[model samples]
Structure formats: structure tokens, C-alpha cells
Target: MRSHLLNDTTAEQYRRSVTEGVERVAAKIAATERPFTGVTVDALAPRIDGIDLDQPLYDTTAVLDELEEVYFRDAIYFHHPRYLAHLNCPVVIPAVLGEAVLSAVNSSLDTWDQSAGGTLIERKLIDWTTARIGLGPAADGVFTSGGTQSNLQALLLAREEAKPGRDGLEGPASLARLRIFASEVSHFSVKKSAKLLGLGEDAVVSVPVDTDKRMQTLALARELERCVTAGLIPMAVVATAGTTDFGSIDPLPEIAELCERYGTWMHVDAAYGCGLLASVRHRDRIDGIERADSVTVDYHKSFFQPVSSSAVLVRDAATLRHATYHAEYLNPRRMVQERIPNQVDKSLQTTRRFDALKLWMTLRTMGADGIGRLFDEVCDLAAEGWRLLAADPRFDVVVEPSLSTLVFRCIPAAVTDPAEIDRANLYARKALFASGDAVVAGTKVGARQYLKFTLLNPETTTDDIAAVLDLIAGHAEQYLGESLDRAS
Candidate 1:
């Protein structure tokens, strides 16, 4: 057991163990034919539950052998090109190498002393990201767990800054009257943040969106005026850069103007569209992102990093004080005067993983353009997919993708009932997932069932999209035919 530790005494053991594990994973990747094995919860649960907690495998090889049967065999492989369900991207090789290195070193980024060079690395990455967004010289940010946490932190700052006379009403006493205006299609995290911050139940005002699925600036203006008239504190206006379902981006320049007039914090949830920042060709899609007071960026979603890499950036570095706290034992008050950089002072998290190293390694290994070109490829593929969906009579695509996602549903030629069509689309998605050839996602759009393809894998070609569409059509047609037979 002592030999298993990762210190200098067991360095050889660690090397051999890690190498063997990597080799096994490489072999598994080579052998995998599809994105998944279609293993059900019932089949996998018992196997996981049967493992005795007290029992130790003693040998790494034996554990690896067991993993092949219980874990790796049924694991959903996001790296596969056809695993087009959500925002998960096939990670880049350089970032994967960074994951390995950072895991071994195990640097905690909360305090500078704990992660000396790691802190600098993360800070530089944050600075680089702010520069890309054109957030100005005073911009600052801290890496977080993911987009949800980032959104929470951003809104938390907005809540704290809503003092009396700044946005109307008293500070903490007016919590119930504090309202956040956001587009109806905005991420659910905005509402969740409002609840977490102890705002009223009706704090989040859902403003309507335009035909493009973007936020309606006129409606937002009316809502802001209403809030002011009603004597409520309009603390924040969240503008989405990329909606989860439609990938629609709200009109940012207009929303920024509204935020200025209303004296409210402007937050842009660019969890998906942040990739466009790196995209040389598609950068204009999120043109007004710089106008946001604060922004959320998820590197894992589109930057091709691994899980647990995201950040919340604020234009005014002083705004980060809302999240700061000074403990005598850790980030002491005196340390602020010592000019020592402590990431925890601006982070919601206390003990944070060095997730930024992954991005740093990625940037150093392959310049930003390398990552940008890969993202460009995926966006191009999504455009091709959208075109294909438009020409095919079996599918009705929603709004054209502003990013790399297409939401559509299979429509049978003879089906008249909308409920039956919804069932067909739902069945098609589930059937495709069960067969293990491809995986897609389904969501409701204005009371109709629709399927979504989040194209993040550059390797996924137009033909792959065509093939998957045909599969969905076949499954839906089969379901509809079975329904007709039952009715007759």
C-alpha cells in the first residue's frame, strides 16, 4: 500500500502504474466502434453496487482488468465523433497531456503559497482570456468549477453591488424587490443563482425573445421601465451569448445600452459561444461581448479542454471584492498589503484545482489559431448539417444555428396529430441511443418535441449527419407505423 503513494519514494511504482493505465485506455479507444455500448442502468448498477468497500484489489493490473468489464465497457465516450448529444467537445491532445501532468502534481490554486507557479499560470490565462474578449486593462477573473458556478458568482457580485441609490431601494432589505431581467431562453442557472442569493421567488423576470430566438430589446426595455416604476431594484440584466437549445445569441449592444440606462449589471452567459472568441472566421457572431460588465466562459464546452474548466470575468477588477474574504490562517488581511496574489480572494471556491494549466498547456503547445481552426471546422460542419436538414422533407429545423448546434424533429409524411409526431421524435431519439450507433438529445420547443445535435467534434462530417438523420427517420417511421397498426 505504501508503494502506491505518488511521492519520490514510490516514483517508479507511480510511473509503471500510470503508463499501464494509459496503455489500457489507448487500447480501449482503438477498439471502441461507437460512442457507447448502450448499457442500461439496471445492468451497470448491480455490478457497481456489488463491489465491497473494505476489499482492496492490491494490484493495479487486476483493477485495470476489472475496470474493462464494469466501467470502460459501457462508458459514454465523448471523444467519439457521433456522440453528438450535448455541449461536450472532443478534447484536444495537448489539453489531455496537461490533464495528466496537473493530476500528478496536484496543485491547489486557492492560495499563492500552495500553488506558486500554478497561480501565475492561472492568472496569465485569465488575463489572456480577458484580452481576447476586449474587456479592457482593469478586467480580472477567477477560474470556477463550470458555467453554473460562474453564473452564480457573477450574479452574486451583481447582488452585492445593488446598493441604495445605485439601482433603487435599500441594500439587503430590498432583496425581495430585487429583479433580474433575462430572455426567456436564458440558461436556468440565472434563476438558480437568484434563488441561491436569497432573492424573491419572482426575482427573475422572463422577458420574451424575438423570432430569431434572440432577446427582444424592446421587451427588455419595457420590463426595465416596469421594474423601476414598481419601485423594485433592477440589479442585473443577463444577456445570453449562446442559448443551450437554439444556440441563439441575444442582441448584446442593445442590451448593454439598456443596462447602462437602467444602471444594472450586464452579464453575458457565453458558455457555448465563447468558442467564437477564438474562432478567427466566426468571431463576429459574438461581436458586442466586450460591452458586458461580466461574462461567463466555459473552456470545456467549446475550447476542447477537459471537464471542470470555466471562469467568471468582470470588467472592473474592484468588483471582485464582493467574493473576497480574509481569514487569519489562510488569505489574511495583511496579505493584501503584502502584494501577494491569492486566487481565493476573488474566487467563490476555497480549495481549487489547477484547471487553468490545461488551457495554458494547450495554448503553448498549439497556438490559439490551431484551436480556432478546429472550432471553425465544427461550425462549418454544423452549417452543412443545417443545410442538409433544410433540404430533407422528413425533418423541420428550428431557427438556423448561430453556433454549432441544430435543433430539429422528424416529421412523418402522413402523421397529422402533433402529439403522435412528438412521440415519434421522442421514440426515434431513444431508439438511436439504445442501438449505440449514435446519440442525440431531445427538447420541447414551444410545445413541440424536437431533437438536437450539438456538433463539437470536428471529425464528424456531413455524411455522418446525413446517416444519423436517416436513422432517426427510420426509427420514427417504424414507431408511427406501429401506432397506426394499433389504432386500426
Candidate 2:
């Protein structure tokens, strides 16, 4: 049993195994030739099914070799320059070091005894972020799993604030009358949160968006007025700091003013655009974020940190008490009276990871200005990509991007029909992915299917964007030709 523990006798073996494993992984990441290997479910499923879980390989090297064959060989490489799909960012090196350190220690951040200084580290990071958002002195926040969890927790707090005394009521009639206002383009989590909170889907009222995909403030104002007129409660206004598909930010100042007038809780889902907090030149893009009652920020999405790094920040610290349940075995009343910081009090989770260490180490090593510069680079690349698409006659570029996402569709000269163009673009996206030449995203803009480029890699340049665009065009043309031949 003592041999199982990492003591003086086993330390050398443990160190060798861990070091070799890390080096192998780093080598693979460094040697990856493409952003994706186009490994399909049908191909990988058989290999995965062949694994014998009950049989343990005594040799660590043999286990690692099997891992390489089954997992690492075809894993999607977000660090690759051509990987332009989704909101995944290439992580910073310091954050990777933080992950290694935190994982080895296995610190649980739920209580002071469980985490000790880990609790302070997370709280310090939260305080630093809240200061950047200008949430004032009373602001507090807790690290969450990701943006979805953060959004759910934010809405939970909003619900508690909206109706303080209706927790154990008979029927959810009051909850049914409560409405959440958000843009038509906002994240799906808002409606999901409502459902989980017993407000039902109908409680979510979708406000219309403008041409740029940002929320229309006038429409929101009118909707709030209508809610008031109907004797309905406008519980919260959910604003999108950066929408998923288009990366469009709503008019936060105007929306915040409307929320203030209507006495509604304001929650901004800034998961994709939270990097604006560190942005040096373009911080003004998220100008009114400071006015939000609560904001969800995903460091993984835009801060170039690993996954599970995000937080839900509240403007007033007292609002976090809504999530507190004094467990006798955990954070008891006496502990609170003694002013010990138990993070479990504010978080939706009891067993939480010290995810804040990643961001803290990243900020300390890379500096906030450096992170901002990296984000600016990607935004600049998107602007350049927009110009390239706008000039090309084959592609129909959407509105100018407010952030690092470009949503557009293919409309080659060969495809005259609207439905045919949609099919062609969809086919091109799928073909491109299957070929593994590039990884791009796709979404539906109204009724038409559009391809998207979500650039989060600072290393990617205009030439790389042009190459991917050319590939997209070639795929679209090939698809159209194939269709024509089939018709003939």
C-alpha cells in the first residue's frame, strides 16, 4: 500500500511516468499537420469498442501507446492555424502549467479546509475581474464550469431577486406570469434556464434583432411596456454581449436603462466576448457591461485559457446569498459568523475545481495587455477576412463583424436558385470538413444556411483565411457541377 503512495520510494517512477506522458502529448501537439483528421464516428466507433476496460496493462508505456492509437491520433487540434470552427481558442502556455499544478494537487475549492489558499486565489481573480468590469466595491462572483453553468446560475439569482417570498408556494402561477426578455439571437441557455427554474418556455419573450443581429432596444422597451400593461412581471432582461453565430453585441447602455426603468434584473451573457475586459483598443465595444446586474464570462472562450474556466459575477455581493444553504457538515452558521470564506456558499456546485488558477497564472505570466493584444489580433484577422469575402462575387458576406466571427453563404454564378445556393453552401461546409482541409462552422440565418468563420487563433493570418475561402469556393463549385451533371 505504501508503494501506491507517491513517497520517496515511488517519487522517481511517478516523476518519470508523468514527464514522459507530458512530453509525448506535447510532441503530438507540435507535430500535428492539420487542424482536423476528419475521423468519423463509423471509423472511430469500432476502435473504441475494441478496448478491454477490465484488463489493465501493467506497463504505463503500453497504456500510453493505446491512448495514442485510440484518442490522440485523431483529436481535433484547436491550436492549428486552419481550425476556424466554433469559439475554441488556442490556450496560453501559462494556463497549461496551471492546469498541471492544480490537477496534481487536486484541491477542492468548496470550503476553506478543503482548499485553504486556493479559495483566496479564486476570490482574488474574481475581484480582479469585477474591478475590470467596474462592478464597484460590493461586487462578488464564483468560478463556474463554463458559460452555460454561469448563465444558469445568473438566471437563478435573477429569479430569486425577482420573487423573494415565492419559493415554496403551491402552484407556479407567479412564475408563469414572470417573463425573461432576450434577443431572438441570444443563447439557448436563457430559455433552458427558464424551464429548469419552473418558469416554462413561454416565460421567455424573444425581442427582435436588427440587420446587424444586435438586439433592438426600442423593441425591448416596447416589450417591457407590454409586459407592464398586461400586469405581468418582467423578471429579467438577458442581453448578449456577443452572440454565438454572428458575435454581435447588443446596445447595452440603452438596454440597461430600459431594465432600470422597468425594475428588471439585467444579465449579460458575455461568454464569447468577455475578452473585451482585457482589450486595450476595443474595450469600448462592451462599454455598458459595467451596468449589468450580473454577467457571465467564459475565460475558455476568449481569454485563451483551458476549458472549465468561467465565472458568474454579480454587481451586488449580497445577491450571492440567494444560492447559500448552510449545511451543518460544510459551511455552518458559526463558520459564516467567524468570516471564513467558504466558496460553496455562492456557487451552484459543491465540489468545484480551482479553475481560477489558470486565469490567474495566465494574467501573471502573459499580462492582461498581452492577452488583449492576442484578442485584438484575431478581431483584426476577422476584419480582414470580411473584406476578402465582401470583394469576392461568389460569396455573400453578412454585416461587418463587431467581433471575431463572420457569417456568410456561398452564391456562385452557377447556382441561381435560392434553395440551390443554400444546398450548395451546406454541401461545401460538409465537404470541407470531410476533406479535413479546413474546419469551419455553419448556422442558419433566417431561412438560409450560412457558413461561419470563428477566428480565435492569433497566429492565423489573412493568407490562411484566403486559403480557406478558396477551399470553400472550390467545394461549392464542385458541388454545383456535380448537381448539374446529375440533372443532365
> Where does model 2 exceed 4 Å of error?
1-9, 165-171
Q: Can you write out model 1's per-residue Cα lDDT over 1-488, one digit (the tens) per residue?
A: 57677898999888899999999989988898999988889989999899886998988899999898899999999888889999999898889899999999999999999999999999999999999999999999999999999999999999888864554455556699889999998999999999999998899999999888999999999999999898888899999998999899999999999999989999999999999889979999898899998999999998999997999999999999999999989999999999999999999999999999999999999989888888889888988999999999999999888988999999999988999999999999999999999999989899999999999999898988999999999999999889889989
Model 1 accuracy (lDDT, Cα) = 0.92
Q: Show the colliding residue pairs in model 2.
A: none
Q: Who wins the lDDT comparison?
A: 1
Tens-digit lDDT track for model 2 on 24-52?
A: 99999989889878889899999989988
Any runs in candidate 1 off by more than 4 Å, and if so which? 164-173
Per-candidate TM-score against the hidden true structure: 0.98, 0.98
Count of clashes in candidate 2: 0
Model 1 TM-score? 0.98
Candidate 2 versus truth, CA RMSD in Å, comes to 1.6
Worst 10 residues of 1 by lDDT: 164-173
